[model samples]
Target: MATKDADKKDTVLATAKERFEYALSRESENLERMKEDIRFAASSPDDPWQWDEATRKERKNNRPMLTINKLPQHIRQVTNDIRQNRPSIKYRPADDKADVETAEILMGLARHIEAHSDADVAYDTAADHQVTSGLGYIRVIADYISDESFDQDIYIKRVKNPFRVHMDPDIIDPAGSDAKWCFIDEDLKEDEFKAQYPDADPIDWQYASDAEWYPGDKQVRVVEYFEIVEKKTTLCLWANGETSFKDEERPESVMAVEKPLKERSVMKCECRWRKLNGQQILEGGDDGKVFPSRFIPVARVVGNEYEVDGKNYISGIVRNAKDSQRMYNIAQTAIVERVMQAPKSPWVAPAEAIEGYEKVWQTANTANHSFLPFNHKDEAGEPIPAPNRTAPATVETGLAQIAASASDDIKAETGQYDASLGQKSNETSGKAIMARQREGDNATYHYVDNLGRAVRHIGRIILDMIPAIYDTKRVARILGEDGEAANAILDPDHPEAFTEVRDENNEIKRIFNPNIGLYDVYTTTGPSYSTRRVEATEAMTAIAQGNPEMWQVAGDLMVKSMDWPGAEELAKRMRLMLPPQIQAEISKDEGGQPEQPQIPPEMQQRMMQVAEQMETMGNELQETKSDLQKAQQKAWQEEGKRIKAEIDADKANALLAIEKAQDSAAAANPAAGQGDVQEMVNQAVAMALANLMQQREPEPMPEPEPPMEMPQPEQPPMDGGMPMPESEVPQ
Candidate 1:
């Protein structure tokens, strides 16, 4: 027996060592992940991979998370348990009740698998990059010094803001497009360019000022941005809005070339500087002759004449000064840079418009994780009134785009666009606060806010670089154990796709709508777009619960995308491309590190008071569970006593009586005594003979829904028991 006990102890030690090694491996994986995270934060000061601000905004505005997932929540809870320290070891075979040991082993295997990740696919890209050259349109500001003209106080202003991007005809939009990627890494404004044709109805034109024809001594300003190469260039202009208000019969704009007399030179400006005197103030202004700058002349100009309103008109050309700091706030490119999501031109809607459609079409936003839904659009532009505009379609499957511009098209938020149509201010409209277009025909520019960014206070990119932050391998490993983890009996083969549910069905309601989605446009497929949307929304909800943190982080990155311009929103977007639930679990697991206790004086005092009592007793009783289980197993095996021996002796005494009954039964009912009939009766009688067999009776079951209360009167007496006045009684 002593030798056997020694052998058992050795076996237990070996098992403990194995478990310790597994836990150590998990810790190592965790450390590696932490390193990766730090690394990611570093290289991408704002966005890793240099994704432009436009691209970031466009992607965030497009890709939303399917929040409302439970996987992430579970990971958070369990990881927190591990971090608290002293968690229960997964299994102790017979020591556990039921199959808990097996369940825990399966969990361990799952954790082990999650400790690493393997997602290779990427999605949600913005437009691709293209070269950009500035253009110029002139704004003629006439000071009424002579008052002799019929235009005194009547400023006959002519603006020349319609300049073509002039792309080499060869550098086409994956299609025939002049527009470049307004947003990061996306295609340019081809749609808007298409909308510019005279017959095209998708016109994004706005009349600059008031009036129809500059009648008399009107001044003309032409601002054009061109590379001005030897090669021929195309001059692009708006069709509807750029026309001179003074002349209603004329075209809005026309393309022209440099005249032989006018000299073309590269426009230049002195660096911005201020006037300063001996006391940082000059009598009139600071003046430098030999080494001068502030007052130096910047541009060269040529005078010219042009045809408009059916006749030629005189105009002054701005050789330069339009591209100065004085004009930085108003350039269309600058305008797009300031605004969150950039559109190639004022005529066409932005990528945000397309993205908004998908968010609603895909997500089941139970937790309001707009995390996956369409981001609101900016709505600052003067929208074309209806009858002039086509409406967004609707679907019964709850898939369709909202009419609400992120700025103020409330038809979306109010759920009125699906009907004949109703609208109001949509507060969620980001479009309203858009970075105004600086150079459409009558274009104006406005200030755009740049989101703040720190300048790498923590300099080491490698120091902060971390691997995939969240995954569930640690928990999986804790669950299963075998020479190979999956072979451990508890590992389930299929995990991510959960068709059957552990809880009640959380089905989203489908409302009636007149429009459909991309699914509807398909020529051949399983279900209509409407049906697909319903399914997608349901899946999104389930997946969301698995990782709300990823959803939230995705939203944050979106704001930054809107703020940053190029390659800024990349790192955050890459993080979003991961499976949501796994990411959440990873975050929770890493975040669950036990904080050093900063116990308050009051709490510390109480702990010290009880230290000699409760704590001391606990320490004294720190025996391991293995010692107890072994002792119990030994005791059970030793006490193998048998009750069957006494019962067997008693049965021998009753055998003679049983034989007598069997013989009588045969004599009493001779007709009933078929072959072996007496034997059957004897067998049953012998079985029920409790005194001889020592058998116990079965317990009775409880009745269902047994009545417990007595009945009560149907009605009670009135408040004063007033039987005196029937009129006063309540009916």
Candidate 2:
């Protein structure tokens, strides 16, 4: 055992040391690569126009030479082997003899090529074009660099020699022998690679930014800087690669012209697939010694380009940086959330249907924002109503009794009960308990109920589900994280897991916390609308003897849930046995009043007198009050009428004042006033304000004193005189 233990320790140590060394090497290499990238980025910077120069120069070739305007008067001789028939191959100045010789040589070469070959190699010939002279070979070299994988370089043959698609196989591997796709650096055994030749500084992404990541842009978006004729946007990618945007006007190489702008608009996602490839090149020296100049990138995916039809689609990329896949996901998820949570009723439901269906409303807006649903639809092809929770054991005899077994017998003998079941059952095993009863599941999962405890159906649903799914999945996913996240996300059901959770004081709780799920349930899945929780209480049948109030309110709720009333006998029995307080609540809930709840004779008599006096006084007060309210209302109405009349008179005067102001303005400045209505407007505004301030509104009248309530003596006191106090009269 000791030997085995020692060996295991040594193995662990070796593994740890290897990992540490590997990590250290990778860090050092990355640091060096990063430094070179920083230097190159600083020096060359990102020349957005660098490729433009190459693009312009790459198309046509122009050679510079001076024309012999005035020739020197010195005698110039013809070349020794010049053709006499051809235009005299001579120069006027002897100093310019070199040009004469160059012309002779070109004529001789032309003759030689025509004599040797049938055709003098006119560009883009059909036959014999494959055969190339030394001069023709040089042109082929240019095509090699121009050819791109995505954009094939093509050259037309006849009327117009457009760019053609051709790739020089030599670029990849001169011979297709032993070509490898990926490679790693030989010096560093720790680092990995992907190409046959590994570049020191390699970039992964073609484009990136500190810009917010918008997954929604894939759906609907405006064209990039769109215009009628064209559109463009300046996109910057800080990468280590040589990248180019394919010019949409004359699309070639990648987006070549044959794919016309009229057909379709283009969209692309350009990642900064840049690489920092380092090379040591000699600067200047006769000896030709080498030194590192600076690192440069080989390739990159830059801003995308597009060309819309001039009449139809101004040139630009259609969907800037996003694609349709993302849009589809959003649409799917939104549709699912909509269908799953459509309101049950199109209009307000009757109160009868909603009386006890309190929690049913919570589903109205519980849009579970994900792309999954229960796959339901009404016959009319619309979404079904809503998620009405399934009730327990549907309207039958309320399974009021639970079967007990040997375990229950022992517990009963000892006068103890399981907390899950309440004490009302008093069921014994092999006799009152129906010990043979069990469900379709495995025996290990079945157990006899012990009385006096309450088992909520919802809680049981959650508990039963845990053994099958989420608990295991959650643990697996958390463990798959950075290892430390495991502690925060592990099964709180385990005491060991709780040990990892530290409180504010950094003290570990050691014991598992049951409230974890309860708290999590509230925070993560709160109801969208208000919902009253349905309390369930099934008397864990064995132990009802010890405690009746164990599941008190819950039991009554479960019974009064007589919305499905097949279990009338059980409810009746439960109600009869309930404590007085519970009994009263039950009565009220059942549309009944409490037992013997009524007024006594003396109190009744007093109440009658008070009511009678109130009624008489109410009648008298109504008559007087009606008169006063009507009079006040009428007076206010008359005042409003007077005010309206005044307003009308003021409005007419204001209009007349405006007209007068206009006449004065026109007269004072005849040239500017006919169309200049400013004076009239000012007068009108002033007069309106004056009129509004001058008129007074009617004020509200003070309320009349509340009418007095005088009691009518039950017995008119023989002469209608007031009765004396109880102390003075005979009691």
Candidate 3:
């Protein structure tokens, strides 16, 4: 058993050593270049200006090897801009199982975690390194909230030194999300190593002979190696549309005798971390301890990444500016040397001219004298000329121009011109100046953009790990976009994880289970909450000044956008003063129920009386309308009866006339038959009836008169619920 244990230990150590060496070999060239870049960017006292050793040695005797580093200023400009406008993580639902409210809860949780961990320091540190040495890193780690607590919390930690980490060279993603393995090294003193791990060997690994990995005689190197391992397993798709690995222990609902809806073989990936040295694995060895997330926790933020001939290359803002910086240094040094070599102003004259005034002339340049009394003539009695002062030589114009050109070159290489660096420029218009500044921002935007990408990846890693790390029910603190704090109850086992409950503020607080949904992450870089508030305040003030009426409607919003101590309270008071309709809308937007207007008792009584009176009048008006309709209907019937009576009278008159005509016809013609007399009477009757109908026209019925409107009682005023006076109300 002892021999088997020893063999297993050797196997683990060998495998770890092999993977570490592979990563080191692949990253050797890039690492060397990165080190040089860091050295150049840091500009430390050792070789701050990157001067050649021989040149520096020679200049050490008598010359100014001044290092006026202009790179740091430009670097700080970009870094500070990023700091002012930090990138924030946002979660978006990617599937039907995910809801917007839950996504929001996830986003808030991420923000809270960031706040708790002081993630700004991590992000800023990584960005600084990216802008300086071309590479930066941040990693997600799970740790117990306290030594006594069993629950774990996830944190985003900063890797202060980029050199301490080595990643897979095969990773093609600029964010390093595709990396298969990574190594983080730590050098411990020999005694410290023994104290920490008494059972582990303290000797340096044979593979880690490189001085860079092993910290010499008294120290030992220990590596934290993270690798992704894959295992094949049967994935069972249940009838309820849930999936789980067949080998995993599940609840009775999942383990029921009912056959699975489907089954398939799938590769499951796990991220495993281990601590090991040259001899054996110190922690997390063959037992296979794994992180909950499948993805590697380390996130890489690179300034600029590309591939050439199948080899990856990384560069930063300092890469191209190095040449310009060196040139600027050289030019400055040359100018200084020229100035030192140039002679001072001196007097020139014949020997006899200053014979008597030698002492005075000798002290002329050193002191301020009233006058110098020189000899009028030489010993030969000839006219002696006064001492003539000669001008000192100046630095060459070419050297000055070179220095200026070098300075410009540094600006051009860094993309931070005079306008960008806050220097006065020829641009007189604000638009033109802003345009020039934008040009500089556009040039350096990649560094900030890359930082955003890394942040987004970090968000993804954290999101993936949340389901496992925060699986239990607990109350978690969440933050709003404006940094307002709120509490959320996370219950993964609940049937409805997205149900909302009212918070202390009476605002809807959602129950979240990060484990319930599929979500995607993205990042938006913009001005911070405070900065945005200032901008909003300025804009609103301008608008209020331009259009005073806008103040009456949006005064609350304007005040709310302010950052003063009492602004929120003031805004709340102002909101109440707005029109009820507008106030309702604002209340709805704030996720609160609209309030009902409160009426005084007297006004309420008056309104009730007015309502009773109005109802009585409405009933009376309805009755009046019904009576008028019935009367009009009765009138129509009477008119019809009168017309029928007139028609009947006409018809009777026609019949009488026909009878008389028939009797006359019969008396005149005794020989004619009775039938002929009857026919003639019928014809006469028809003729008479036709004439009567043609002579008289039927009259049209009269239209009914419209009903008069009833007078309504005056209503009480809604404004301040004021009651109308009794004298003004209609009786």
Candidate 4:
């Protein structure tokens, strides 16, 4: 098995090297042409105009030559504009549908990319255009680095391209198309080359036997080529179980037999090698360095170039300014050369009469003002008048006209006029100035548009790698709309991932699961995106000032757009400053509204008065109860005494009646009436006892006395010293 694998690896490496050579051959002339363009755009310091040594020597005797470099300035200006308004990554719903989870993932990845790669990308982008030859390439690489704090080791690198990169000229789709794209770096050091292929055989350095290592000597060239290759991709039950199953320690719950699968084409990397810097000799290796990526890490940023003759690439702003700059330089040289030949002072002398000519010339040359003592006599002693040549006025006029024309041409070609540079110009009003600047900006919008497209491409690459980056369940810090950070679990493994959130109704609000569908990535651009946030905030503030109801909402928006430290925290504190009633309204749930806590001072005072009145009534009720009990007790005692008196009166009446009855019985019959009298006496006694019992009957309970009313305080007498009425007194 080991021998078979080794043989396969050899075949792969052989194929990779062959493809690398093929790509180089196809793009060799193009690369050379690009280099020439770069040389013209950014001239070397040693030779600014790139003239040969002999040409330079000849030019020194002719006219003054000055290389006015405007290329760097133009490149800097465009780059600065981009830096000022750098694009940020935002996740949009696929098919313009809103997906919060997708958005969160995109945001997290965007923040990561911006934090790690923005600086390098910006620098490389500027350098690419400034070089005026090669298209900038930002390589996005993902690896597991042990030292990373978040355990996320996706890298965006600005690789130094040793050769102009090439993609299939016919293919437009960078990843999906069947284009063979390759990134080449030549003359790599022996150690660097070995690092990539550590398991392979050591390189036999050609000049290592008798000498120490020298730069660019005994070097190896490395090429990483990406092409579409067909392979058998199995989608059987067993394959799914092996890949999609989350747990490795346990067997899959569902089992099925492995089966044959259809063959499919996929984009893969084929790393190739050549010894001694693209020499005919090939290095032996176990297969090429390929990775599981749909696209090559290298990204292309094609500049704004018109394809006139099927050549898409062209020089940037530097190319536009080149002609005018050269013209300006030559004009300046002419002026200087003219000045050099012009005389400061003029003199004339009769040849026959001239004496001590050398001495006179010396005096004129040495002194600022001098009188030469020479005889004004010829062989015939005749006088001759000396004349001064007027300074050529045309020299200054020619210089001025040519300089102005060159400046105007440069402004027209590059769209870098006075207004764009913030210089005061012939435009009278600020509006006019702004209009002019906008016109100039519009002219160069293509470059900006290209950059935007490149940025979008980068975003697309990040989106493509999302599944792999978030392959496992891991906690990622997501930035909220308020710019506050919150931890969220990115689980690409589960269907119900990111479901731990709820809406105002307390119902589950799950962001879309990334494992399902694709998310469309779009870049926010133009003035609408750039300044709309500020405008919205301002509008919100203006509305809130009078209405006051929208203060918290507007403040939050302002804080979001405001580019300052602790903006979110500041917004939170400001929200806390809102009136309790307003805060309650803002924090209310869908079905449950929070009660307002604030109360008016007048209403509070009334409530206090009502509470005091209730307390007074309670005290009065207790007193009245005690008095009623006392009155009833007194009435009960009086009634008991009255009953006892009545009983005594009844006893006396009964005794008198009995005595009368006994006397009547004695008068009727002396002897016979004696028994009758005794009997009558007995009956009278019984009747008296009955009467006493009747008199001693229990009396009814007495009614309680009415409670005493509280006395009203007295009031001062009105007008006539009369006492005040109870109705008039204050309670």
lDDT (CA) per prediction? 0.27, 0.29, 0.84, 0.58
What does candidate 3's lDDT look like per residue over 301-412, in tens digits? 9997778888778888888888877887888888887776555478898888778678898888778889977787866788987778787667788877887898999899
lDDT of 4 by residue, 1-731 (tens): 99997677556555555655665665576567666656766664455663445646878656556666556565666666766565555676664333666677667656655565554465446445533653555566666646655455466666566354555555575221234545444456677776865653333322222234344456654444454444433332244332232222222444544432333333233322222222222343343344335555555565544455655454556656677877776677678767766654455555543455665655664476555555555556566544234554236787868978997898888787889867789999989999998987787666666656566666776776667676677765555433455565666665543465666876543343565554666666544343656776777767777887565445665665666789768886666555566667776733245544434455455445555655687688778789779878887788788877886788688878788878776776678646667987798779767867765666556555666665433323222234434355333
Better of 1 and 4 by TM-score: 4
lDDT of 1 at 623: 50
In Å, residue 567's CA in model 3 sits off its true spot by 0.6
Clashes of each: 109, 40, 0, 0
Q: Estimate each model's TM-score.
A: 0.16, 0.17, 0.76, 0.66
What are the per-residue Cα lDDT tens digits for candidate 1 across 1-731? 97885565444333323433443443343234323322321223233222334645664544321111111222222222222211111212232222433334323432342222110000000000000011111111113336583321111122121111112222222211221111001112434333433232221111122353232343222111111112222222334223222222333133334112222233231212122111121111122111111111111011222345543222211112112211221232233333323221222234554354654433332234443333344476543332112232222221111211221222221112211121233333444323111111011000000000000100011011101111112111232222234423211222211122222444321111111110001011123233444565556556557877544545433333232355346645545444446456655564432223233455455444444454444443445344555666665555433234445655665776677667767777777846677676667576648554455333343233332332221222222222223343222
User: Which segments of candidate 1 are over 4 A away from where they belong?
Assistant: 1-311, 317-624, 634-640, 653-731
**For candidate 2, what is the TM-score?**
0.17
Question: Lowest summed-lDDT stretch of 10 residues in model 2?
Answer: 133-142
Checking candidate 3 for backbone clashes, the offending pairs are none
Better of 1 and 3 by lDDT: 3
In order of TM-score, best first, we have 3, 4, 2, 1
Clash pairs detected, candidate 4: none
| Highest-scoring model, lDDT | 3
TM-score of candidate 1 versus the correct structure, residues matched by position: 0.16
Please provide, for model 2 over 580-644, each residue's C-alpha lDDT reduced to its tens digit, 9 standing for 90 to 100: 66667767664456543233455556556656666877787679877978887887788779778
**Best-fitting candidate, scored by TM-score:** 3
User: Which TM-score value belongs to model 3?
Assistant: 0.76
The lDDT of model 1 is: 0.27
